[model samples]
Target: MPGPPKSDATHKPPFETEELRQKLAEFLDMEVEVPGSKAKKKVGNFQFGIYAFFDYDKEPIYVGQTNEQIRTRIRRHLTNQRTDAVAMNVLDPFEVYQIEVWPLPELEGKDSKDAAAKKILNALEYQIFVKLREESSFKAVLNEKEPGKPDFEVEIPHSYKGIVVSDEVFAIRNHPDVRIARRASTLSRLAQIISERQVQRGLRNTLLTQATRLRALTERRLRGLEEKAKKQGAEPEE
Candidate 1:
């Protein structure tokens, strides 16, 4: 089969901020290979950090944090345990091509270490979440979790206006890997729905009532995604 389009022109990012870009580059300096013959979890010994998952177009989809090591936390989402993302039908692992992390200063043996880091991480995640939710170009992001309340101030990237590049975003939508990942995600959701139904046998009426409301919300979100896609025109980025 033919491969993805070959272009001569250089790829340009929709947004760019010099300082933020530099920071991202530095954070992802080391390798965090996802799938290999041997299983590997955790990348660097980053104690406390905030990380983001970007799709094929370099658009941020999810933002999260860690208490001990950034790589270990991310490994959970990418590899074995993606329960949160899959349950919500938000993130499709195949779409994620790269991850960027911002390591926070780990204050060991300090009374305020855990508290301080938690506050900063929450604020940073929320800041990035709002930015992505408000972006004019992208469609739905996978951050279905509640936005963390801003407690402490931590700088987050806010501009995108130049050449931004990272892990290559594979354009091979029809690739076997992509199809398998997507199928697995679909099955996950199906399993959840089935399990919930089985357990709600005694509370069928209440389940139906809640399902109705949830369906309404899902429909609304679907329409929103459709509108966003239209606005993005041909070959819209998700």
Candidate 2:
């Protein structure tokens, strides 16, 4: 009774939604400044995915994902890192920052229960960015968020104990001292002196301990012999 599912000749492809775009941008740490009114405005037929870069000068400091409201997340990174003293090292306080975003095709309908939603979104994000950019673009998914980026704390162990004057700064000051010290010191002879001291200390300790034990044993044996002689003298003449 249904005539081929009533195909519509006027049907058109739907556009991506701002919510999805904003969410993707937020996660990617992208700074796409979509207006609040625009983001608030609702569309029934569309949803979008986006990836973005939080760049410091030409270098990207962080990447993230968003579906809608990319501005919020991007601004958060910018403001928080600059204003907060603690995050300064991670964000590099002295560097200037910038942000850019990649928009992807909108996903349709309720995606809450969609089993393959993340995979689908990743594929879409990757495809859209690749199409839009000449250079490679990264798309970070929310569910599959990027791995924790490591921040190695480089330190000269000796620096904590003393000020690190430049090697060149102190070079002239140490030149005369170094020459005098090296002329006065002999490495092989110093080793011989150390060996001699160690051997002397060891021998002294060994002799002292042995002498103390011997004195105690000798005194004990003499007391025992004296006791035996006293007992013999006290006994009957048998």
Candidate 3:
């Protein structure tokens, strides 16, 4: 398999800001070396404060974030007695590897700390929550629709369409005769209602467009008349 494309450009971030520094600080505080390993001493300089995605049995799962050491966090996750034991079951100790570090903030105040951490985490490019199965994935389900129309109607739950006929208008139109006329009416009657409403809307939109044009023309004419009056040295009556 081909690896990712190689670019000639040297990789470097444009500039690091104060917020980034704070997140980096938190990141540096939480890394651990594999026990009884000769490389443990060498790994001490590694920082690990960010959230990471670890795969288990080749399936992408488990997301964790911590200001605490990564070794400690992984240990807790692997243990059965901890509060998040169910989450731990999915991860194999040998299979666990730090894929990426999601940065977090180091702040003094509680609210500020929480907000900063969230901000930095959100700034991460990947959808960490879904990749970790922390949130449900929004799959595009196939929808059935009437022929000749678009199949999918995007529905935003609880969004307001608009108020139909004003309360006063409905109240007056709700009278027996009006209701009877509308009820017994066939498709033609329904068509009449729709057509009339559409015609009214069209008329309104047309009038608005014409009014705008008229206003522009009127202003231009006024300016021309003013210029003419100025040349004749006559008082132009308003």
Cα lDDT of model 1 by residue, 1-238, tens digit: 9766655343743232233344344443444433322533233454566677775446565667777666567656654456566444445555565576665543323343567656776787777667665661433345545455774567763222222233233334434445445545544564466566554332333233234433544555567667888888854446
TM-score of each: 0.50, 0.27, 0.26
Candidate 2 deviant stretches above 4 angstroms: 1-48, 54-57, 80-89, 92-96, 108-115, 124-238
At residue 115, give the lDDT of candidate 2.
46
| lDDT winner | 1
- Tens-place lDDT per residue, model 3, 1-238, is 9666565353743222232233333433434343334333211132233343332112223445454443355345433326232221222222222334433223212342465444443333234434343331221100111112222332111100111133344455445344333323322333344455544343343233323333444565577778989999997758
With a 3 Å backbone cut-off (N, CA, C), the pairs that clash in candidate 1 are 15-160, 15-161, 16-160, 16-161
Residue 6 displacement in candidate 3 (angstroms): 58
Whole-model lDDT, candidate 3?
0.35
Candidate 2 CA-lDDT value = 0.35
Q: Which candidate gets the maximum TM-score versus the true structure?
A: 1
Residues 42-104, candidate 2: write the lDDT tens digits. Answer: 211124334334221132323344443334444454444432211322232122223444433
Predictions in order: lDDT: 0.52, 0.35, 0.35
* lDDT value for model 1: 0.52
Screening candidate 3 with a backbone cut-off below 3 angstroms (N, C-alpha, C), the clashing residue pairs are: 27-49
